[model samples]
Target: MALWSGRFTASANEFTQRFGASLPVDKRMYKQDIAGSKAHATMLSEQGIISHDDAEKICTGLDDIEREITKGTFPFDINDEDIHMSIEKQLIARIGEAGARLHTGRSRNDQVICDTRLYLKSRISNVMRANYQFSRVLEKLAHEKQHVIIPGYTHMQHAQPVYLAHHLLAYVWMLSRDFKRLHHSYEAADCNPLGAAALAGTTYPLDRQRTTDLLGFSAVCENSLDAVSDRDFVLDTLYACSVSAMHLSRLAEELIMWSTQEFGFIELSDTFSTGSSIMPQKKNPDFAELVRGKTGRTVGNLVSLLVTMKALPLAYNKDLQEDKQGVFDSLDTIYDCLTCMAGMISSMTIHEDAMERQAYTGHLAATDVADYLVKKGMAFRDAHRIVGHLVLLCEQRGCALTDLSLADFKAQSSLFEENVMHELDIPSIVRARNSRGGTGDKALAYQFNVVKDVLHQQEELLNALTRSVS
Candidate 1:
């Protein structure tokens, strides 16, 4: 018979027992379940709701169960329904009547929510660290390849020249925002919900603050119904994971495109690439493609949780059991994708010469030519029209802007001067834009310094979380 079976006259059908079980999905939270039990027992004893000897025995019994689970020596039955019931039943069997006293003022509703929060708090820290690691790789790549010039595109057409460092740093900023989202998720999960027993306040003299302190929570959930029913923490985590995975997908899509024979901008290392079984000359960027594809799963996980929580009148529901698997799967997927992306960025080879060649090929200097005319005091829109005609002339003549004669320049606009020649040089064009946050050398150096400071702060935060969770 089950622990709650004392009120029932008959056993549950086998299929119903198996179908209602969450042990498989939630068994990973065993440590959190044990820790919550110990805190609750200690609080119960301090409040004079239970005997000190009974609380001590329950704590010792929980410690034994934790050790057994950690060592993989504990017996787990699917009929136990979930990790909380499994550990509690085993604790009662080990410590007799005292073990049964552990849940005196609590219900599984609050117990499971408390365990989920604790579990997510730790997992959020881990995902944050992984995100930080990926950002560090981007930072390192930007610093090392600071001088590599590439054609910056808008609408997939060459629009300007930018340092490769500047391009990579854009993704770093995206990841920095992802780190903030994960931190917000951590804050959402830091509240203790252990005293919100069964959607209402318990009658026993329970000290919620003591359990909060014991569990290292920053505060206790104020409303019992809200505490057990709210899953916004889970939603926050899924949102963070979803956005971060989308960033990774964007980066992966670029890597896949850059490694192609048509682009030749980069070559993924042999270790990160795979060969076609049928084609002898094939080396594929399969890992990047995989990361890009897995992003769909993360997005679906977020939507799945949202739909699950959308319409239910909360307080507590069996539907909440659907929460952990999606969150767990999304977190694991994002973590693995982050590590893989970091590996790809760290190992790939950049073809600087190819990038430079492409940087100069597509009339990339057209914008600079117009800027040159503007500097000569031509009306800006007129200069744009003149440069447009000049580009068309160059196209007809099968020559570049730099290849045009001084006469050809004067024919387009009298404002065109010998200085226009300098504007056509790709490197000169790249270095001319020295405004704040531009792709110029000085701008890149400033951004790199900012990245370093942000990384230092993230390291401090990660260390603090490590201490708190420990």
Candidate 2:
């Protein structure tokens, strides 16, 4: 019989039982559901709502159920419908009346909400930790490649020269912002909904804050209906995940371009790349491409949840059950993607020579030569025009600016001294960007220190959580 079978005389159709069963998905929340029940049982006993001896027996039986599930020895039934009833039914079979007492002052509505919050909080913490690790790998790469120069692009056209480190740090900043978003999502899930009961507050005298503390929540939900009905926390997490996945997709897009034969700026490790089925000499960035493609599903999951919740009223409904699978899917998607990306970033080989070589083409140092003229007392606008004309002549003669003679320089502007050639060199052009936050050595060093400190703090938090989880 179903848990709510008291109100109905007829058995549920087989199709209905199979279709409505969430065991395939919500079964993942088993550990959390058991944990919340243990806390609630302790609270029930401590408040004299249930006998202390019964509480001990319920706790012991729940531990046994956890072991049975972990070892794949427990009988999981589809007709149990979801994780909550499955665990409760198992408890009753194991410990009789004490197991029945475990649900004192609670409804499956609040119970499911509580379990989902705990599950989501733990998952978000993991994603935050992975994001931190990915960011650290980026910081290390940026520091190692600080002196390597690359062409800066505007509209995919060479516009200036920038240290490759600066480009790497740009993504580090984006990931750091992602970490903040995950933190906010964690806060959204950090409240206790266990005492919300069905649509109204529980009639029993219960200590909601005690359960909240036992489970490590930051606060208890203030309103019963809001607590049970609110899947906003999960939506917030899904939204944050969608944004993070989008950021990763953007990075993956660059990795795809950079590893191409045309760019040749990076080489993916063999373990990260895949061979073509028929092509003779193909090393494909399939993992990066997958990361890019998964962004669509994660984003779609976010939109699905938002629209699902738009019309549902204040308490729990069947529509709310539609929330968990998408949330769980998005989390798993990004978690695996971030972990893989971190592995790829840490293992891949960088082609510094290729990066430096590309920086030298397309008149990358034109602005440096123009700056020399301006420093020699020409108006900035005049300097720009002089350099423009020099480039035009070089194009006309089918020669590079460096191939022109001193007379060629004198023809353009007598201000172009012999030293102009040295000033227009590629390395000099990169070194000239000495302002704060520029691509200069001093700027990269400063950026590295800032990123290192943030990563250190993040690592500390990860270690602490790992210890707690263990």
Candidate 3:
């Protein structure tokens, strides 16, 4: 018989039983279910709904169940339908009517929501810590490569020169935004939803605030129907995960390009690479490829949940059960992908010489050259055209613009002088950008100190949180 089979004349058929069961996937929620039950039991005792003695018995029983499940000694029955029912059934069998009283003013609708919120709070904390660790690794890499130079680009054409650290810090800032999104999602999941019974408030004189405090929730949910039917917390979390995965995919794509011989910007370690079966010398960045590919699944999980909830009516429905699997998958996938990315980044070798070589090939110093001519009293527009003509002459002669002699430069502009040679060198151009946030050594050093401060603050916050949780 099912938990709600009191008035039914017959049991569900095997097909119905199999189709209705969530035990396979929702068993992961057993610990959450147990935790919520303990909070509810404490509230009940406080509100005089159940005896303190009974609350103690229920709490002890839940603790025992937790131990049994952790040790793989608990028996799960297929007839229990879901994790909540399975645990409730066990509690009743072990402690009699006190276990039956556990659900006195509660329903599975709110119970499941409570468990989910509790689960997300913990998972988001874990992700935030992982993100902080990854950020620290990136900061360390940037600090190590502060002197390296690379060409910045626009439309795949050389635009200017920038420090390699400047390029890497760009992604660190992008992921910092991702960290903020996860924090918002965590706030959305912090409200307690345990007092809403089905689609209406129960008349059992239940103390919702007591349970809210016991569960460490920031507040109790405002509306009963909204509380039971709401899946927005899950959606917010899934959206955050999807966006973070997209960020990871973008970084992975760059890693793939960087590790290639054509780019020669970086090289993955053997542990983070793979070899082709037929090509003995081929070393591929398979980890980056996997991270790039896994992004699609995380995005799909977001769309799946959005589509599932689009047509559902008010209050709880069977359609809501479809919500858990996708969120679970998204969380698990992003966590694994972030860990893999951090490992790859921490171990990969940066090819500074190759970066410097490519930085020089694209005439990255052309802008500086044009500026030099303007400073020599040439009309700014005239200087730009003169440099443009010089670039054309270099292309026609199969030589770099810097390779032109003083006579070659004088042919384009009378203002051209020997000092232009120093201005057109890659390192000189990179180092000359002394403005704040520029690619110059002073700017990079300032930026590095700022990033290091942020890292230290992040570590301190994480340590404080760890102590509180412990």
TM-score of each: 0.98, 0.95, 0.95
| Candidate 3: tens digits of C-alpha lDDT, residues 42-102 | 9889889999999999999999999998898999997779999989899999999999899
lDDT of 3: 0.88
Please give the RMSD to the true structure for each candidate, in Å. Answer: 1.1, 1.9, 1.8
TM-score of 2: 0.95
Q: What C-alpha lDDT values do all the predictions have?
A: 0.92, 0.90, 0.88
lDDT per residue as tens, model 1, 289-379: 9999999999999999999999989689999999999999999999999999999999999999999999987799998888787777777
Using lDDT as the yardstick, the better of models 1 and 2 is 1
Let me know the TM-score candidate 1 reaches against the reference structure. 0.98
- TM-score of candidate 3 on Cα atoms, chains taken together: 0.95
Which residue ranges in model 1 land beyond 4 Å of their true spot?
A: none
In lDDT terms, which candidate is top? 1
Higher-lDDT candidate among 1 and 3? 1
Compose the digit string of candidate 2's lDDT tens values, residues 1-470.
97678999998899998888888999999899999999999999999999999999999999998999999998998688999999999889889999988888999999999999999989999999899989988888887888899999989998889998899999998998888899889889989999889979878999999999899888999999899999889988998999999999999999999999999999999999999889969999999999999999999999999999999987789988899999999999999999999999899999999988888777877888889899999999999998999899988998778888988888989898889889768777777677877887777788788888888887887787666544
